[model samples]
Target: MSFDLTKAETPKADDAETETAPEESAARRGGLVDFLSGPAGRNLGLVLALVLLIIVGILTGGERFASTDNALTILRLGSVIGVVSVGMTFVIAGEGIDLSVGAIVALCSVWATTIATQTMAADYHWSVMVFVALAVGAGCGLVNGVLIAYGRIAPFIATLAMLAAARGLAEIIAKRRTQIIRERGFVDFFGGSVAGVPVLVIMFAAVAAAGWVLLNRTTFGRRTLAIGGNPEAARLAGIRVQRHTMYLYILLGLACGIAAVMLMARTTTGTSTHGTLYELDAIAAVVIGGTLLSGGRATLVGTVLGVLIFTTLTNVFTLNNLDTSTQAVAKGAIIVAAVLLQQRVARTGST
Candidate 1:
């Protein structure tokens, strides 16, 4: 038909290339959005926050803050709390709260350090103390789980009652005195390190790694997320919401027990005062780590970063000689800001 063969020969202006340019651009934008809205994105923000804190520490604390010793101190300070935060993460992810974590830590520490427990450790092995601490922690967690899961008690009330009861019990056991750890083996085991890292820090790392795997790579984690996201939906899907929920609390209890041991090692004493206000610290760390207070989502990495950030902040404040009142005020401000930012990010992602 004497068509424009010249035009056809000219490759039709390469419309495909031009068309794909827009598509490619759109794809790039989508990739960026996904990264920012996903765990990577959340962790990126935390990393940025930590970097900012580091910068602040440097500026305020000068060489003192920049020293290796200071850095180790920060990590050491964060280690115990970080372990507890990991457990707190699981509990929150399961759509539950644990106000008794601090009390449980106190109770575990006191119980493990009791005259009888210590006597057994002195007679046999320090593992006895470790076992008792873990048992106490698990027992407390079981009680909380039973009340919340089977007894149909509210998490807040149940844990609050535990808070009072546990703390009181610890006080009664310790008789308002600090119980010094006499088992040298227990202290050395948890207090020692591998390859220059503090044992406390190492334990924290191990727990965090295990927690990450548990939450992201296992069936149990999926079930926890399902329950937290929607208990009804998860149940409809055949997930055991009640039993799983109990497991979550018990998980937290074990964490508290570990934390108790760490604290006992660090301070060489177990007192009712041990873990005072720890619930607040652990909850704050978990929340700031990008875990949804209402459940459904959690980030163990973010929680670790949150713990570090707080530890660094405290270090910075201490280095700068800031008063506790000022530090408290600053913490409150950070918490408010983090929650606000989290809400904004959530909305942006949804849209």
Candidate 2:
């Protein structure tokens, strides 16, 4: 056993190195795969939420949930809300909020209603009406953008002021009364169904698809996420953060205006109190769908599922004779739960 100590130790050390090299390489590969395939593959909460929503829809609405007719109905109802949420999504993705969407929508619809409701015109040109309504909405958004971007105001405060002002303007325009209006025959097509499919549904699809591409595929989307993640870092990277923020707010305003057209068409009337509490619902949907309010990361499909879950729940509650107060309580509880889940996920991620 008294062999040459140096010669004996050299081979032993070499053997140990040979063994660890392969083992370490294998472990590294395995870790990478798991990271890519597990939680890193996609937003698990969002995917799970979609599955649960489909199950609930099937359970409550039965075949009606999966059926084309019911699916079409969901799209139709979800579209207008979805459109506003699209802009909301961008705003939230960029670490901001717009509280004035509902009021802006009410204003836009009432503006269009005045023109369409006129008896003497005898013809409500749908295209012209839509343009005017949307322009008004864009104008509101421009004001909001300037206030928040250049005026150096918090988004919540600026939009909240706009919310009160816009609602007041809407009420004044409607003479504080619900205005009943009839559009020309063809002008009503936006609210009408084609081949049993609602036009609003088609519009929603177009907008959502376009939005998805913008957020996922464009440089603008990447820059939005980057700024949300770290504005200072983004600014260092040569991105004009303020300009982008302004664009996003304006875009949100336009979306709200579009939503107004849908709502007005569906009801054919303008009311001062219309779209009340819709911002809450929209925010709830976005959050419940697993979109992070912290900004940078968002899920468009998840928002869709969130909207469906909320509306389905609302519809079911109504059908079951639930009181409005109870509904409010239920919605609030659900929102809290969703935020809690997101918080847990973040904690786990950090750990």
Candidate 3:
């Protein structure tokens, strides 16, 4: 009986170990899954890509590419586009596109830097120019939202029309000339910085941080994701898909306005050519940052990294004496690679 009891207890212990092993294994798997889906995991590839680019810069451009001044220059140049990219993130996340972002930037800048706006700024305050730029940006966004969300026009068609009209309007207003900003206060304030960082860079950081929070921690963001994932389903779920879509466009407009102000400060002039090809750049950055072009997923961190990558890439190319055509070719290749990688990731996730 004693020998039989010992054998029975051995079997029970073995069964217990078998049960615990699976639980432990499952716990480990769950943790891995969570980490991969989290922010750090989401951005790991971009981080590695950035690091590799930096290494290339160091190797090819040596000290010139590694200098702190050059680094700041990259950030400074990327800031305006980075801000615009933040807005583009929201729009694209909601399964909408705004091919008119560049045009809108040009229009806002021209409007804000016009002689009339300058005179008003001189009489009242520099804030006048800021307000005007914001108003114009929001207004254009409103029109786009209305056309797409309510009029039921496709995003591509609406934004394309806007791209043409806004650019034309900007050309008309500026008479195809650059409008110089005369508000010393405006320039000094926006161009100025705290603790040796450029104000433009600070603005970019602030906007990016805010965008991340808004997109991740708010009901509006949830609704945007829901709508992007499935518009009909989101509408059926009482998400007010149309209204939310309108708001997303308007949010993008506000970002364009902010970017306009930053651009004016950086260049001290507003021209119809302020954001040439910026829409393509923003779209590329957003796509490369891991946001789905088909919607339903987004990543602010990825977008920031994407912006830095392009900025750094340009800096590297410049330091190495590369030409614009070469840079364009490089960018095209990177975009293609990123899309392919994203597709593979999507397929793997689905499986």
Best by TM-score: 1
lDDT of 3: 0.93
Cα misplacement distance, residue 44 of candidate 2 (Å): 5.2
Clashing pairs in 3: none
Residue pairs that clash (backbone atoms under 3 angstroms), model 2: none
Report how far residue 2 has shifted in candidate 3, in Å: 22
* lDDT string, candidate 3, 1-351, tens digits: 346776665667778899899999988876776666556776997899899999999999889888988889999999999999999999999999999999999999999998898999999999999999999999999999999999999999999999999999999999999888878999999999889899999999999999999999999889988999999999989999999999999999999999999999999999999888999889989988988888989999999999999999989999888999999999999999988877766665555
**In every candidate, how many clashes are there?**
0, 0, 0
lDDT string, candidate 1, 11-102, tens digits = 54477789789999988877887787688988988899899999989998899999998998999999999999999999999899999999
- Models ranked on TM-score: 1, 3, 2
Per-candidate local distance difference test:
0.93, 0.79, 0.93
Which portions of model 3 show Cα errors greater than 4 Å?
A: 1-38
Question: Candidates' TM-scores?
Answer: 0.91, 0.84, 0.91
TM-score of 1: 0.91
Report RMSD (Å) for each prediction in the order shown.
3.3, 4.1, 3.2
